[model samples]
Target: MTPQDSAGRGLFITFEGIDGSGKSTQARLLAEALRGLGRDVVLTREPGGSPGAEEIRALVLEGDPDRWSAETEILLFTAARRDHLERTIAPALDRGQVVICDRFADSTRMYQGLSRGDLRGLVDQLHDLMIARDPDLTVLIDMDPDTGLGRALSRNGHEERFEEFGPDLQRKMRAGFLALAREFPARFRVVDGNRAIELVAAEVREIVLDALT
Candidate 1:
């Protein structure tokens, strides 16, 4: 079967951002908006969707961050994503539903690939090995990592491994995300995350509607 056939009817869309980018907020809003349009939308995330993945997520985020090497961290994310795709994402898409994920492959490219080292090639390799299909659209909520991290610290009240990354690492991660966006301009859409939530939500809604159409 062809790639389209492999992808089936489900539209895979992912939201990517640093700690305080409001990615979860926007992703949820997008899912709700799509559901309002009477479409079946499955909301999922990497490193924590499925039961197994949720366990992995805790280990990766809450456990000893220094214990795991960058490659190990990247592989863990890939493993979690592979499970999420096999059990949740791909199936939902095949059934003609809309899948809105909080984060996906690009997160690896940014957090692990860039911050840890030049793992760009490895990110692509993971995509080839784990993800059978590219997302229909990817929305990158671009934000200043410091601002985002500050927001996270203020609102969420704590920082995770990725969130605690230094300013230099965060900058590299941000640059990596932009590069990833450039790699798939047609499928990649960037939304300024510094705006008011309502305004960002509105922009995301427009992009999703346009993409679906």
Candidate 2:
């Protein structure tokens, strides 16, 4: 469905950054902050937000790095996103709740476009064809690749397929995300994520609150 087709009364916010940039944490914190203000908040993530999407998440994140080709991976991610939008995000937005997603199409665009190949046009086309609505605001947690990769590696999980691509790719992804922020300035809020968690969260909270106001 297109953006105009899925019009809702709620706010949609998404966090975008390379892995270990603390986007997930920040997303959570922002949700908590909003909820504290008595707003209905739906905290979610991509690759898996709805039940079907979660299952697809495992298929994409658990397999070997080369298990799926770039094109195939994009398809899987898009499918998961479609399910997420249908079963989870759309309903929450229709309820007028604030929906904060950890990662969204931007991740797909950067990961598939940079790490895999120059398939950015394909990503855009697929997104426009399948899922076209962007978040009302996208918080981009910007940080150095080395620090982000180190933090990502420190975490324990089977969802390491993307992380296995290593630091060089992370650097490229970082650059890609920043470029996207510039490309869509009205919807992008670039936050410095290299500071302590409290500092980053405070800045992110302020930005989001301002948007709501």
Query: On residues 111-197, what C-alpha lDDT tens digit does candidate 1 reach at each position?
Result: 787777888789879879877567889999999888887777677532276666656666777777888889889889999998999
TM-scores vs. true structure, each candidate: 0.91, 0.95
Model 1: weakest 10-residue lDDT segment is 1-10
Among these predictions, the greatest TM-score belongs to 2
Q: In model 1, what lDDT does residue 24 have?
A: 94
Runs of candidate 2 exceeding 4 Å displacement? 1-8
| Local accuracy of candidate 2 as per-residue lDDT tens digits, 1-213 | 322223335889999998999999999998888777777889999899999999999999997899999999999999999999999998999887889999999999999866799889999899999998789999999999999999998898889998999888999999999999999999999999989999999999888777776
Model 1, C-alpha of 15: deviation from truth (Å): 0.3
RMSD of each: 4.0, 4.4
Error of 1 at 140 (Å): 0.7
